[model samples]
Target: MAGDRGAVRRARDWTRDWGRIWGGAWHRGDGTILAALLAAWVLGVSVWPLARLFLEALAPGADGVPLGLMAEVLEARSTGRAFRNTLAASAGSVVIATVLGTVLAFATGLLRLRGRVAMTFLILSPLLIPSQTMALAWIELSGSNSPVLRPLGLAPPPGTTNPIYSGGGIALLMGIEHMPLVFIALRAALATLPADLVEAARIAGAGRLRILTRIILPLALPSALAGAILAFAAAVGNFGVPALLGIPGRFPMLTTLIYQRLNGFGPSVAGQVAVLALILVALALGALGLRALVLSRLSVPLGRGAALRPLDPGRARLPLEAAIWAVLAVIAILPMLALVATALSPALGVALSASTATTANFHEVLANPTIRRAFANSLLLSALAALVCTLVALPFAWLKVSARAPLIRLLDWLVDGPWVVPGTVVALAMILAFLPPLPLVGSLYGTFAILLLAYLARFLPLVLRPVVAGAEALEPAQDEAARIVGAGPLRRILFVLAPALLPAAMAGALILMMTAVNELTLSALLWSSGNETLGVMVFALQYEGNSTAAAATSVLSLLMVLALALALDAMRRWLPPGTLPWRD
Candidate 1:
C-alpha cells in the first residue's frame, strides 16, 4: 500500500512537470490568461459601449440630419466657453496638486520633520471629507454676508462679493480632492530610496538644494510624474466638481460635456458625444501609457538579500522639520474644517452668512427617506459586490502571481484594461452584454447584479493587487509543512494561507467598497430603482435643483468613505511594522 501511494504521487509530479514544460509554462501561461481576461473585460466594458454610443450618434434621422446634433448644440457659445473653462480648471488643478504633493512628501519623508505623524494625518484628512462640503465652505467664505470673513475684515461687507465661481473654483475643488494621491505616491517612493547613497553624498559636502535638485529630484521624478499623470486623469474625469462649481457658472470639461451631450441633448446627439468621448479615451490611454512606460524604464530590481536602512531623526534638523510640519498641517486641516463646518451648517447654501448655523443639515440628512434608501443600498450593494469581486479576483490574482501559466498571463492584460476604460463605456457595455440571449444572471439587465459586475470590472484590480502582493510574500515551505502533517489542500489553505492574506484582502475590499460608494459616472448610467446607490441619489437631487439635498447626499458618501479610510489607516499601524506576510 505504501509503495503504491508513492508511485501515484510520483506519477502526479511527472505529469505536472511535463505540463509546465510544454502546454502551461508557469508565469507564461498565467500571462496569457491575464491577457485574455483583460481583453474580455475591455471589450465588454469600454470598447463595446463606446462603439454603441458612437454608432447611435452617427445614425441619421428621417430629415437627413445626423443624429449627433447634440454636438452642434454643445458647440454653441455657451458650450464652447464651458469646454475652455473645464480645461483651465483641470490644468490648474493638476499643477497645484503635483507641486504640493511633492513638497509635502519630501518634507515629511526626507527632512525628518517634527510632528510628522500629525502632519501626515492632516494632509490625508481632507480625503475623508466630501468635495461638495468644500465647495459649500468656500462659497460661505466668499459670500458677502459670511460671518467667517467679518473677523478678518475680509468680508465684502453688505452685498457685493462671492467666491470666484469661474475656472478657479473648480480647480481648487479638484486640487483638494487629488492632493492625497501625490502625497501617497511621493511618500512611498521616498521611503524606498537608498539612504546610504544620500548619506555618502552629504559626507562629500553636497549642498542641500543641489542634492535635492540633482539627485533626489531625478530619482523621484518618475514616481512624481506617474502620480501627476494619474492626478491629471482624475481631474479631467471629475464631474462632481465641474457640476457643482463649474456647471452653475456654465463651465464644462470633457466629462461634463459628455454628460450634457447624453442627458441634455438626447439620443440624436449621441454621435457627436461619441466623437468627443473618443478624444477623452485617447487622452486617458496616453496618460496611463506614459506612466507605465516611465515606471518600467526607471524601476530598479533588487537582488536577493539587499540591505535596508531605517530613517533617523537627527538633533540638528529640528527647525527645518518644524517648518515642513507646519505647512503639511495647514494644508490638511483647513479643507477638513471647511467640510465639517458645511456639513454641520443649519442652512446648506448660506455659507458665511450667519453664526446661527446648527447641525440641522445633518439631522435632516439622516432623517430623509432618499438618504436612508441610498445609505442602505450603498452599504448592501458595495458589501455584496466587494465579496463577489474578492472571490473572483482571488482566482485571477493566483493565476497571475502563482500558477505562472501562459493562459494566466493572457488574463493579466484583461485586468489592466479596466484602468484605462471610461466608466460610461463600461455601463453601456454591461447594458448591451446583458440585454438578450446572453442576459446576465437574474435578468440583471436592470438589477443590482449588473452593478456588481460593473463594479467587479472597475474595481477588481483594487482587491487583486494587494492580495497578490501578500500571496507572493508567502513562502511555499509553509504549505509544504502543513501537507506533510496530513493536512489536505483545503485544510492547509484554511489554516495557513487565510490568516496570511487577510490583511491585504480586507484592505482591498475596503478600497473597493469606498470606490463603489463614491463612484458616479457608471453608477449614474447602470443603477436602477432597485439599486439606487448614493451617487445616483445625489445626481438626482442636483438635477432637481435641490442642491442642498445633493450636498447632503455627497456629505454622507464622503463620511462613509472617511470611516473606511480611517479604519484602514488604523489597521496599517496596528499591524506589525513590516511589508512581509507576517511581522512581529
Candidate 2:
C-alpha cells in the first residue's frame, strides 16, 4: 500500500512539470503573435495555392486522388519534347554562364586591371535589363535589316531569318542573362579567400599561375558549382527569353508550353498545365539538392584573415584589359546602341542615321494613357510590396533567429518555396486559389490585389534573407537588458532591434523594389487591362509589332533602373559593405 501511494505521488509531480512548460510556452505573447502571422502568411500565400494545384492535378475530376491524368500528361509527345528542350537548354546555358562568369570574377576580383569597376558594372548589366527587353535588343541587333550593323556592312542578308530565333540563340541569351548570378557568387567566395595562404605560397616561390590553379581555384570550386546550379534553375524557369525567342524559333520549353496551354484553353486546362509546372519544380529542386550534396562534400574550413590582394598582371595587363573591354562592348554596349537606334527610327526596318533619327516613338509611348497607367501601376505595386515585405521580414527574421522551435524553422522553409518555384507556377497557383469568389473580396481574378499578393509571396525571401543575416549578427545582450528593465516585446523591438536592422532592411527593400518594378513572368500571367505593368507594356508592344514603341519603353525602363542603382550607390556609405551589388 505504501509503494502504490509513492507511485501516484511521482505521477502527479511529472504531470505538474509538463503543465508548467506548456503554460510558459503558450503565455509568450510575442512568440504567439509571430507564429500566428507566419501561419496565416504561409497558408494564404504558399501552402494553399500549391496544395490546391497538386490536388487538381492529381484529381482532375475533383472526386478523389487519382494518378491517371498525371501519367497521361507525362506520356504526351509534346510534353516529352518540352522536357528534353528544357533540360538541354538549361544545362547548356549553365555551362556557358558558369565559364564566362567565373572568368569575369577572376579578372575583376584577382587581377590588377584598369577600369575594373566599369568592367564589373558592364558585366552585370544584363541583370538590370528585363529579360524581354534583352531578347528584343538582341533581336534588333541581329536582324537582317539591323541599323547598327548595316552601317558597318555587317548586317545579315535581307529576307534572311533573325538567327536569335533558334534553340542555340535561346541558350546563348539565357546564358548571358544569368551570368551575373555566377559572377556574384564567385566574387563573394574570392573576397573571402585567405591572404595568408596566398602569401605563404608566394614565399614558397610559386608562380601566379601555379598558386591560382593549386590553391585559389580549388577553394573557389564549391562556389562556382553552386552558381552553376543557380544558373541552371533560373534557366529552367525563365519565361521571357523562351517566349520571345522560342515561339518564333519553334522551340518550346516547359514554361512556354504552360503559357501556350493556358492561353489557348483557359483555366479549363489548369490540371494539365499544373502537371507541367510540377515538372519545373522538380527540376529546380533537384538542382538545389545536388548543390547541397556537392557543397557538403566540397566545403573546407579556412583561417580568418584578410582577403588576397590583386596580383600584378605584368606584361599581360594591356591585352587582358582590351579583351575585357571588347567583351563588354559586345555584351552590353552594342545591344544598348541597337536598342537606341531602333527606338529613334521611323519604322522597324528603317536604318538609323543622323538624318533618319527621330524621337517620335518616345513621344508616342509617353503620350499614351495606357502606357502612363502601366508606369504608375508598376511603381505603386512594387513600392507597396517592398515596403510591406521589409516590415514583415523584420519580425519574421527576429523570430527565426531567436526562436528554436521546429515550427519557426518549418515556416522559414515554407516561405522560400514560392521563391524557388517558377513564377509561372506561382501565378498558376494564384489563379487556382483566387479565381473563385472569396467570402469578403469576391473574385481577385482580374484584380491588382492578386498581383500584389503574388508579389508579396514571391519577393518575401528577397527581403527576409538579408534581414535574417542582420538579426543573427545582433547581440542578444541588448534584448536581455531591455527585458530586465521591464521593456515589453513591442518596446524592445521598436527601440532596440529596429535601429540595428534598418540598414540591411533598407538595402533589401531597394533590391526588391528594383526587381519588382518591371517584373515579367508573374505579371505576364496575372495582368489584365487595367493591371498592366511596365513589363507587360513592353512585351505587348513588341508582340503587336510596335517595335519602335517597345524599344522606347524599354529604354525608359532601363533609365529608371540606372537611376535607382545610382541612388543606392550614393547611399553606400550608410549601408553595410557589400549591400549594393554595383559597389566594391
Which candidate's lDDT is highest? Answer: 2
Cα error, residue 156 of model 1, in Å, equals: 4.9
Whole-model Cα lDDT of every candidate shown, in order? 0.65, 0.87
Q: Count the backbone clashes (under 3 Å) in each candidate.
A: 43, 0
> Ten-residue segment with the worst summed lDDT in candidate 1?
575-584
Model 1: runs farther than 4 Å from truth? 1-86, 126-137, 145-147, 155-161, 265-271, 296-331, 348-357, 431-446, 477-496, 528-530, 538-556, 573-584
- Which structure among the candidates has the greatest TM-score? 2
lDDT of 1: 0.65
lDDT of 2: 0.87
TM per prediction: 0.78, 0.93
